[model samples]
Target: MTREPRSGCPIASTLDIVGDRWTLVILRDLLNGKSRFSQFLSSPERITTNILTDRLVAMESAGLVTKSPYQARPQRFEYKLTRRGEALLPILQEMCLWANAHIPGTWTPPVSFMARKPE
Candidate 1:
């Protein structure tokens, strides 16, 4: 299911898929080793369940994440970033750097996080 780009502009096109309020936050959670639905819900951002569900589905469709069933009884699943998703690591790292440097109240993450490269 390929989505039509909103425009030919590179940044705008990228934003079309990941520009939503919750998507990048979800991406951050995935990078920081959160995979389960409940784990995402536990983030300090306090995303509502419906929005989380929508973001996860959109991400999966965008090839940023893959969902696999982790439980059988009630059919629960876990999400993992694909290579395409992992490629966004640097973007997130830069965002953290910008926030830490420009946003006075922002918390700086460990150096290890900044050093991470997509695998």
Candidate 2:
């Protein structure tokens, strides 16, 4: 179920889905090719397991990701970006560039990430 956007403003509507503190960080991880639950946990932001679970479920519901069983014994899954998700790549890329340009002490994003365009 989609939440009502706060207004008709395009950016506000977009933020309605991706505005939370962890969502963009998680998106960066996904765009960087981390798909497994454990891989997400290993990110430097150190998201708690419960919050990670919440974000993944919300993202899946928002059609940003699709998960498939990767291990059947214990039913583990790996996630992949949907086309809708891939379309957010340039947003992340621009964020990286913006931060590197304006923020002090921020790690510069890799050339691969900077150059990557939305698929």
Candidate 3:
């Protein structure tokens, strides 16, 4: 699915790349320090292998994450967030706060994560 924005609005442009369920979940996992493919696979939401692969490729293309080979034999990789991706931290933090206040059963984000800055 091409994510070309329909207009030049900043929100619209960002949504073009991240307007999906899995992408932000993947971003959340990255922010929480999960890097390897298996680590992402272990999330409670239980993302499937195919979807994970596709999202990782999309994120790589969007310049949100970079993949580096950890194993040369089978070509395993670890995904690290780029500065662009790190810049989403505050947005995620605000979203978490909103969810905790308005959404029942939502847990508070960790203090460390709440206190963290992108830099």
Could you give candidate 3's per-residue lDDT for residues 1-119 as a string of tens digits? 45668899999898889888899999999999999999999999999999999999999999999999999999999999999999999999999999999999998889988999997
Ten-residue stretch with the least lDDT total in model 1: 107-116
For every model shown, what is its TM-score relative to the native structure?
0.96, 0.94, 0.95
Ranking by TM-score: 1, 3, 2
**Model 2, 1-119: lDDT tens per residue?**
66877999999988988989898898888889999999999999999999999999999989999999999999999999999988998888888779888998899888888788777
RMSD of each: 0.9, 1.0, 1.3
Candidate 1 C-alpha lDDT tens digits along 1-119: 66899889999999998898999999998999999999999999999999999899999999999999999999999999999999999999999999988999998876777888999
In model 2, the clashing pairs are: none
- The prediction achieving the highest TM-score against the true structure is 1
Candidate 3 positional error at 37, Å:
0.4
Each model's lDDT = 0.93, 0.90, 0.93
Higher-lDDT candidate of 2 and 3:
3
Provide the clash count, candidate 3: 0
